[model samples]
Target: MNKNNLIYIFIICFTLISCGKNRIKLISENSNLILPKDFKILQNETQSTGIADFEINIMLQFDENNFQKIIHQVDSLILVDPNWKSSNNEYYYENFTNQSEPSNIKIYKHNKTLKFVFNHI
Candidate 1:
């Protein structure tokens, strides 16, 4: 093959491998989860939400339907790759707490489509 052809082949192969080399696939397929009610993710778990402590209701259970396993699995992967580096995909987890909710909620968001929701309790 010509030198130019060889160079092009190498570049294409390199791009395909490099494209996914750093990516952390949190899930084979993305699943989205929505927070119940008007509740939104709290940036800080410690911050007071201005709601009555007892009034908060945030009890969540992890199940196959909710796909909470992906979040937990990613948590373990983060230890291996502390950066959890990804080229196209995003992995995010946040501690959520509200004034009325007695339980703590952990929200795991992967890219735009994959989301896992579960309570800390």
Candidate 2:
């Protein structure tokens, strides 16, 4: 099950998060969502275009069943924000009252990891 690769990813996420340089964490071992401590992020993917809007996408390399677990974890957080809505298994969230914080997260099975795509504004 490529336990080493799984562990490797786990370590990397924690290191990045601890230093406050990146946002990644384990929702569960089988899942590979790379969520932050508070399930929030500023700029996940860094591609500057005009206004420098950022969209985050982090890959963890897990499978489908595990991906489901990741999805559940995310849902828990989404419930906190009443406006959250699920569309085709994808979630779109925005906290209009608090600095306009928003999160758009998606999950998919990748080569060996479940890819976690995050878009927070």
Candidate 3:
């Protein structure tokens, strides 16, 4: 084979390998929540408080925008277990009467981390 032919073959092989390694992960269109790094997704009856019969818990760290987006769409969010049993169907939002002081909205500082807890009940 000539020098030019060898170069072309090498370029084609490199392109194929690079493209194969750059495969895109297809995420569900309806999924708006993003899971955090090293987070655990728990979906077991034993993990429930017995009041709900079943539960699905996702522990993760989120940014301000992500957190706000979640809070805004909390009503529409659904919690699904490994068996595909949803526990968020009967979920109801209680009144914010317990909040004595007005809920304050403040800007989070750089590198600040916040924990979000969501119960199935």
Note the residue pairs that clash in candidate 2: 44-56, 45-55, 45-56, 61-112, 61-113, 62-112, 62-113, 62-114
Judge candidate 3 at residue 78 and give its lDDT: 36
Off by over 4 Å in 2: 1-44, 51-61, 96-102, 108-121
Residue-level lDDT of model 2, residues 1-121, one tens digit each, is: 5999999999999876674444344223213234432333333343343364554454454445555665676677556646445566455443334343333334433332333433334
**lDDT, model 1, position 31:** 20
Query: In lDDT terms, which candidate is top?
Result: 2
The C-alpha local distance difference test score for the whole of candidate 3 amounts to 0.33
State each candidate's clash count.
2, 8, 0
Q: Encode model 3's per-residue lDDT on 1-121: one tens digit a residue.
A: 9999999999999986664333111011113333333322221112454665432222233466665554444334434312111222222222222342111111123322222222234
* Model number with the top TM-score: 2
Candidate lDDT (C-alpha), each: 0.37, 0.46, 0.33
RMSD in Å for model 1: 17.6
lDDT-wise, the better of 1 and 3 is: 1
Model 2 TM: 0.38
Candidate 3: count the clashes.
0
